[model samples]
Target: MFRDRGPAWRQANAGHVSLGQLKVTSAIESCRRASLGGHVERSEDCVHTQIAYNACRNRHCPKCQGAAAKQWLAEREADLLPVLYFHVVFTLPAGIADIAYQNKAVIYDLVFKASAETLTTIAADPKHLGARIGITSVLHSWGSALTQHPHVHMIVPGGGISPDGTRWVSCRPGFFLPVRVLSRLYRRLLLEKLIATHKAGRPYVFGNQTPLADAQAFAAHLAPLRNAEWVVYAKRPFGGPEAVLAYLSRYTHRVAIANSRLIALDQHGVTFRWKDYRVEGRGRQKIMILATGEFIRRFLIHVLPKGFNRIRHYGLLARGACAGNIARARELLAIKKREDAPTETIADADKPRCPCCGGRMILIELFVRGETPRHSPAAPTRAIRIDTS
Candidate 1:
């Protein structure tokens, strides 16, 4: 689909596509191809040979996420607490999504900051949980249909550490925090920071949002959101820490759309499956067809800025401090830490078995990109020898 549609999209959106988006497109086009270099493997019996191309490993490439997601989940599994985990979602209202699209890095960072402050502050209240909570937040910029709908999905422990750090404070069963309270605080904090950013001349505004370049215009745009009830939804608690890992496996490294979702590609357009949340029940699983340019445009809009982080940890789970905090929490709660399991290296696990004989395939040669494969009886001077055993 990219090969067929990418050129037209590039032509139509020239000068508008970001360097990050262009890099993503280029990487996707070259992913798992010999142009990026690869190795040749021969079966134990030397009767079968296979060429394995290196992956581009670009974060946005749908083909490269499986291994990355697995590795990430493996590391995260060790951090889980033997406690209930709640799934909370904080979403931006449509009024703000326009400005968010223009200032993705700034707005998304504020989303994380505001949401984290709301959760930790409320949980720290004496009338509430009165403890410090940990949060794992993942930002998603697209809805199911690939439209720009910015939101943060959070995996939060159902409880927190007491203010004095002496005890494990658990929230009431089946409850975390009041949604209305969280909504109000998040709205206030986000607006305050956004206005401050604009005043500092740091927030980006473009295209139809050029009016927001004026401070008064920007303030007027955010006026309605000040009184509006922002959306802060908390789903039922995860079954357990194990269930949280399963959920993260699906969401953590997800792209706007997976290759498996593409149903068809032709000169007319691309057809893909998408869920319509507004539709009720089974009817929501619907199909959408878009012209090639339109589809690419929608997908590329979600390409985040370079070096911007979409996943963040907060409070107790803050990276530098999580280890000590988690250890202390587990001890206070009388929860036993699971011993590390012996496991094969990722390469050993991912090594492909011979398709012809179901035997092991060993790397036999490494080829630099753009170099022609040698065909002579004698191996090339540059070929590195490997043990077949």
Candidate 2:
């Protein structure tokens, strides 16, 4: 399903993406070639060797996030503990929207930092029912309307440990952190960062074009944000381990809106469904129709800086001490490795088959790690994606 993306009739009217976006589009189109050990097999009669330049499988590349997600999940499977978890969202005020645009890399990074730090610091405080917590924060850059709306969705386990890190501290079954408290602190942290960054840079290099470019004007612009209630909503607890994985699957590598959500792209631009969060998500109530160029422009804004990791781990999952901490955590819980716990499976479907006998085919040779797949064929000419999102 990741392979075939044919140009859609809808994107026809959507034209002329910005200059900054061209390279990313090309990168997405060219990722994962046979040269990089991708699938490109030749037929029996072929004599000419084929050439396929492999894709640099980077997460920012829309084509590669899926493969990364699969590989990443395989590794994270070892990190999962048997615990119920909470889903918390941290959102920003639209007042900070313009500033975020001017400083996407830095501001986005701050969003991750502030949100994670807030959660970690608060959770660790003795007054707040302190305990070490595991959290997975995924950055989302777009709203359903394709706007550059940046927020971090955090999946935190329902409980944590004592401030001294001895015993587990559990929350009520339905609650995690206090939403009112999280929102108040999140707003303050973000506004402080926004003001600091604004003052640090040409803060108003483009202010001459704006009525709000002056210090007073900018201050006024940011004033309401001081009291604006930022949204920090917590969803009910997830069912269990598989549910958490399923939740991560949707969010961890999500693009603005999946091709599946696209309704139509026509003379008026593109029309897609977005949830009206202001109202209960009773139904897909709003239809956002955009000019094709504008739609492309909005989509391009989400492409992050090269190698910026949108998914992050905090607290116990921190890389440096993850293994030791997890071991200690398991011992505390008296959890032991299951004798029947599944190891990697070699699926029959993935095994080689005989062309002649319809029996399982034996591998006469194996390609070692540094070695390439055998008899690799040239990658196919670029195919058009008929699919749309």
User: Which candidate should be chosen as best, given lDDT against the real structure?
Assistant: 1
Q: How many residue pairs clash in each candidate?
A: 0, 12
Cα error, candidate 2, residue 103 (Å): 0.8
lDDT (0 to 1) per candidate: 0.89, 0.69
* TM per candidate: 0.93, 0.76
Off by over 4 Å in 2: 1-20, 31-39, 42-62, 202-217, 263-273, 279-282, 285-289, 338-342, 345-389
Worst 10 residues of 1 by lDDT: 374-383
List, residue by residue over 1-389, the lDDT tens digit for candidate 2: 11232134225434644334555655555565533444322333433233234566656565566666666675777777787888998876676666666556787887888788888877877677578887889888788777867788999877776667677777767777788888888877876776776677534435433665566666788898888788888899999878888788778887776777788866676777888767775764787887666666677778776657888898888888888777777766778965655655434434444333345444333333245766644444454689786
Per-residue lDDT tens digits for candidate 1, residues 1-389, read: 77656777788789988889999998998898879888878779646776777899999999999899988987887789988999999998898888888788888999999999999999999988999999999999999989999999999999989988899999999999999999999999999998999999968787888888999999999998888888999999999988999999889999999999999888668899999988999999999999878888899999999999999999999999999999999999998877767878666788788766678988778888896544222232254589999
TM-score of 1: 0.93
Return the top candidate by TM-score.
Answer: 1
User: What does candidate 2 score on TM?
Assistant: 0.76
